[model samples]
Target: MSSTRQFSFEFFPTKTDAGHEKLMQTAAHLATYNPNYFSCTYGAGGSTRDRTIDTVKHLNDVIKVSTAPHLSCVGDTKADLRQLLTMYKNSGINRLVALRGDLPSGMGMASGELRYANELVEFVRKETDDHFTIAVAAYPEMHPQARNFEEDLRNFATKVKAGANIAITQYFFNADCYFYFVERVRKLGIEIPIVPGIMPITNYTRLARFSDACGAEMPRWVRKQLEAYGDDTKSIKAFGEQVISEMCERLLQGGAPGLHFYTLNQAEPSLAIWENLKLPR
Candidate 1:
C-alpha cells in the first residue's frame, strides 16, 4: 500500500460565489498531498463552460497545480472546442479529458460531429501536435449504450488508438471489474495506465441514484451500513472511510497502478482515506 504510485483528483467548476470559495478551498487542501495532477470537470449540457476554463486557469496559475480541464462534446461545435483548446494551450495546460458528456434531459441524445469520445480525441489530435496529453473515460461494466461488454472494450481500444494517453474509468465498487478490464485491455495491446476511480460514499440512497445512473455495484456490506446508519453523518463518514480504505488496500494488492478519488468537492473524507493509505506526500 505504501508503494510509490501516481494519484490524481477531479473537481467540478463552480457557478456560485460560495461554490467558488468551496472549490478553491478543496483545491488548496488537496494540493497539500501533491497529487500527480488535478482535473476540472465539464458540466452536462454546457452549463459551466466559462467556469470550467476559469477554474483551470486559476488552479494552474494561482494554485500552481498541474491541471487538466475536461472538454466535453456536448452542445459544442468543433470551432468552439478548438477555441477552448487554444485557451488551454495559451495557459500552458497541456492535458485534457475528452468526453461525450450527458445530454440535457428530454434531448433524447446529443447531436454533434463529436458523437463519441474517440471522435473528440481525434479532433484534439488533429488540432494540436504533441502539445496536449489526452485522457479518456472507460467503463468496466459496459456503457449504457454499448451493445455488449466486448463492444465496450473495443470502443475503449478505439479511444486509445485515437490519441488517449491515459484512461480513467468510471467509479465502481468492485475491484475485480477494474482488474479484469485492465487485464483484457492489456491483452488487446492497450498499454496506457488505466487508473481506478474510487468514490467515497457517505449516503446510501443518494449513492444508489448515482450507482443506478453510472452502473456501479454497491456491495451488500455497504448497503447494510447505509441502511443501518441512514442520515447519521458521523456513522456515514466512519463507514465511508472503512469501505474506501479496504477497497484501496485490495486495489493496491491487485496491482492497480494508481488511485483517483472522486472527492465531490469535500475535504475531510478524502483526506482521511489518503491518510489511511499512508500515501506519500
Candidate 2:
C-alpha cells in the first residue's frame, strides 16, 4: 500500500543446530536496516515446516521484526494447512507468502488437493478473516508450467481475487521482464503490489543452477564477471554488490514498489545493496 519503494528480505531455515545461531546472527544484523518485513522460506514439500515456523516466530518475538513465513500446499492436506495457519496466528505472524511449491524430486506430481497457489490463497481466506495479508509468487518470464504468458497473468489475477495482498516474483536477471510483466498485469486491473525479487550472484555455478531450475536466465555479462572473479570471495562479493545495486536502482526508477532480496542466509550482499540504495528512513 506504500507508494514509495520499500525493502524486504528472504531467508531459509537451516538444517543443523549451528544453523540456528547463524540465522539469528544474520537476522539481528540485518534488522537495523528496518526492512518492511522478512520472510523465511518453507522448503519444497513441507520439508522444513517446523524450522520455518520457529525462525519466523523468533524474528517476530525476539527480534521484534515483522515476519512472513512461506507456505506451500504441494504436499499438505487441508487439515495440515489449517494447523499451520493456526501456528502462524499463535506466533503473531500476520503475513504469509502463499505458494504452490515445487514438487519433490522424482515425484513429478503434486501430492495435495491444492494444485495451484490460488487454491492455497482461497484456503487462507477461508481460514482467517483477513487477519493475514497473503503474498503469492508471480513469474515474469512465465511459470514453466503455464500454458502461456497470458495464462500466467490470469493465474496471478486469480490469486489476487482469492485474497493475496502482495506478489513477489521469482528472481530474474532481466529488468525488462519485470517491467513488461507489470505493464501487462496492470492492464488486467488486479492492481496489487508486485515486488521484484532480486538475488545477488555471488557464486557463479550455484546461481546458474538455481536460475536454470527456476527458468530465470543468467545473462552473459554476469557469467563473464563471475568467471573473472574466479575463486576470490572479495572480488565476487564486490561484483555482486554492484550488480544488485544497479538492478535495484533501475527497478525503482521504472516504478517497482520495492525490492526483495533472496539473501541465501548471508547478510553481506543484501546489506551492501541496501546501503547502495540509500533509502530514507
Judging by lDDT against the true structure, name the best candidate.
Answer: 2
Please provide TM-scores, in order, for all candidate models, with all chains considered together: 0.96, 0.95
Candidate 2 RMSD to the real structure: 1.6
TM-score of 1: 0.96
Worst 10 residues of 1 by lDDT: 1-10
> How many Å off is the CA of 88 in candidate 2?
1.2
Clashing pairs for predicted structure model 2, backbone only: none
The per-model lDDT (C-alpha) reads 0.86, 0.88
Per-residue lDDT tens digits for candidate 1, residues 22-118, read 8898899889888888888988877789899889998888878899998889888998888989988988998898899888887677866688889
Clashes of each: 0, 0
